[model samples]
Target: MAGLAALGAFAQAAPMVTSLGPVRAAVFPRLTGLGRPGHVALTFDDGPDPASTPRFLDALDEAGVRATFFLLGRMVQRAPALARRISDAGHEVALHGWGHRAHIALTPAQTLRDLRQGRDEVASATGRAPYWYRPPYGVATAATFSACRKLGLRPVLWSAWGRDWTATATPESVFHTVARDLRGGGTILLHDSDCTSKPESWRSTLGALPLLLEHCAEQGWKAGPLREHGIADADAEIGS
Candidate 1:
């Protein structure tokens, strides 16, 4: 009976993972990280890498921009000081779980445990509790939402992605990929680390940063971290 109940819960959540495309974005804007008009949210995932993250940080600093970095706990543990540097440099630090595993692959108990452990690890390294969560591969389950509620974390996914994880991705390709779907009030996803991607893929992402910011500036849009993207009010209304 206990096994059956867990299976039922998993069954109910499995479809959401596969169905979170344009329709889901249109129906659940807040969950897709949509926010205020004339503003764009900048975010990265699977990072705090010692070699590459610093370069991304330097690029953002030079551009006078900040972004939210969704960090993996194992990565944070390996580079705690770099994690501290991320917060100290004024970017937002958010949880990306203990490992880069999809919630759909974990049972409800496993999902909660991963989130809690990652949240604590991030808080310990950054000295600030993370307010947002982005699951690996942008896949969320019913367990993901429930665990976020229990841990006081809000789930957010990107509206536009650079597809910068590929070996074939170039700076121009990254920019154009994001530009194809990016609009004001959209969230842009890129990677600052290549831990889960092709080696040195972050270089393409780093190169595309200037182009993305320049494009946003040309459109009279303010691009910054999620905190400044105005998600709180939208989330409040949607979650209610």
Candidate 2:
């Protein structure tokens, strides 16, 4: 069954290793300059929806690509089967809070509760806790980072974003944003589920995926998990 496969993959991914240590530093991907061979990480947020998630998965399958998904805990509870599909397909699943609330507005205790609930729901659905946490709308506070460290999740923010959460954003616009902003070691943010809108804002994302993947191939850019690059070390801060 799909659930068994997901469990097997989770074991292979070794989520327990991620939980073993406290995070010292969080490093996002460094941007690469033009004409240089680079790497990009593709990430999605706010989903596992029935309508849009399947389409996104089909596109990723067609492209032979993988991505990280920061899934909302409440949504996972609503669509546990779809969450299993995401895990079974070999994508990284991370936390995106319980209801997509802004972290800056919540007390540290409240933030911890939301993160704990989100991680628990995701792990329950997929059989492994996530190692990354992306705050809703890229809004983070000192409290958010503290909570992340306490929960054994690293705070992951994108180096570039497609702003695909907008209902009016066209596929072409999404493509342009990604292609124009891409750099080596950059994290590109896209959405597979849009809980913020009435019908959800994933149509543009679905339409933009193939073009983005093709462009990455043309540019010789590789894509992988966010943690694969490792956290930014003390040296990077000194150099920067």
Candidate 3:
């Protein structure tokens, strides 16, 4: 029965992971932002690594940019100080999950528990309850939405990602990948931690940061954290 229930849960979640539309709308509250022209938002995931996170922070500080960080609960527990630093540095700290498991892999109860636990862990570290949540791998289901509403958090997804977790990714490739899809009011995804990602995957993202920012500058786009995106909960939703 347990296995059957898991399979049934996966069935409901599968559609949302691959395609956006009715399933996307039916499952979660709307995702706002990612529209307009020249107002790109930069977001990072799976982070707060002591070694890499601070480096990213330094880079963002030097660049005069602020970003949103979707942090894993376990990682936050492992590096609370680093998590605090992220919030202290004026970045948004959102919930990723307690573990890096995809929503489909968890039962509805488990998913909610993971979201709450992750939210609590981050809040403990940051002294602020996060108002945003992004599921692991950007996969969501009816349960994810339920959890979001119950926890009083909003859901967000990206419009473009660098694919920087691939071992062969380079700065040029990362920059080009994101640049091609980047538009006005786009949400750009990148990683700051190698914890759940491919080892050393953070390097390419780090290397591409300045270049990506430069491209945004040339295009006259302003990049900042998601809090400034000015999106409503009635907007379109994104799939994994």
Candidate 4:
């Protein structure tokens, strides 16, 4: 059944443990970035890349849509103006770690340092502090949770993703891949940069944007940034 399949897909998407998928879906639904009914959160990661991010900005602007951009600290440093431009365009800017490495591979101290540096860079660049954090590769560890707590950040992961980082991805594929698991109140993950992906894969993501927006329109569900998605920190007592 369609409902059963969506449940299955959600379980696969929000794994608490890298090896255990269902537990997180069952236990931490809020952390999975499921927001208020009739709304879908649009989010992009690994960017502020000058090459492709601008294209996404242009597309989003033309569509009259806004999104959350989870920016890497190192990338922001390379293009602080572009990073600020994202915020200036009314997009929600969030942290995606200082580097592209997974938290599970780093020591506790390293993880904490990475988050602090990233949070600082994003705040400095955007002139607003980020309240949300999404670990690189969506992999979270004890240290990651600890760091988030210290930083006063709420950790969020996607309920659906485009898997558009592959070299072979096309616009239609990206749109459908996300559409498969997507529903109202779901957060959709995409990448605006190929800095950590197969080169130029972001072109596919850019092209997929209109289809996704139109699909949400047809479904009568509003699509916008996480801030507008109405995901409250009180939804769950994170790091408790």
Write down the TM-score of every candidate.
Answer: 0.91, 0.80, 0.87, 0.90
Tens digits of per-residue lDDT for model 4 on 79-169? 9999999999999999999998877578889999999999999999989899889988778766777788789887888888888999789
Model 4 spans > 4 angstroms off: 1-23, 234-237
lDDT of 4: 0.85
Q: List the residue pairs that clash in candidate 4.
A: none
lDDT of 1: 0.86
lDDT of 1 by residue, 1-240 (tens): 332234235436664442355755675678788888899999999999998999999999999999999999999999999999999999999999999887778999999999999999999999999998988987776677778878989888889999999989999999999999898999999999999999999999999999999999999999999999987544342341
Candidate 2 lDDT over 148-232, as tens digits, reads 6678886666666676877678888988987776766667788887677536568887888888888888888877656554445
Q: Tens digit of lDDT per residue, candidate 3, span 59-177?
A: 99999999999999999999999999999999999889899887777889999999999999999999989988888877766677778878988877777789898988998999998
In model 2, the runs with Cα more than 4 Å from the true position are 1-37, 198-200, 229-240
lDDT of 3 at 144: 79
Q: Using lDDT as the measure, which candidate wins?
A: 1
Top model number, TM-score: 1
In model 3, residue pairs whose N, Cα or C atoms come closer than 3 Å (at least 3 residues apart or on different chains), thus clashing, are 37-184, 38-184, 39-185
Give Cα distance to truth, residue 140, candidate 4, Å.
0.4
Model 3: runs farther than 4 Å from truth?
Answer: 1-35, 235-240
Candidate number with the higher lDDT (2 or 3): 3
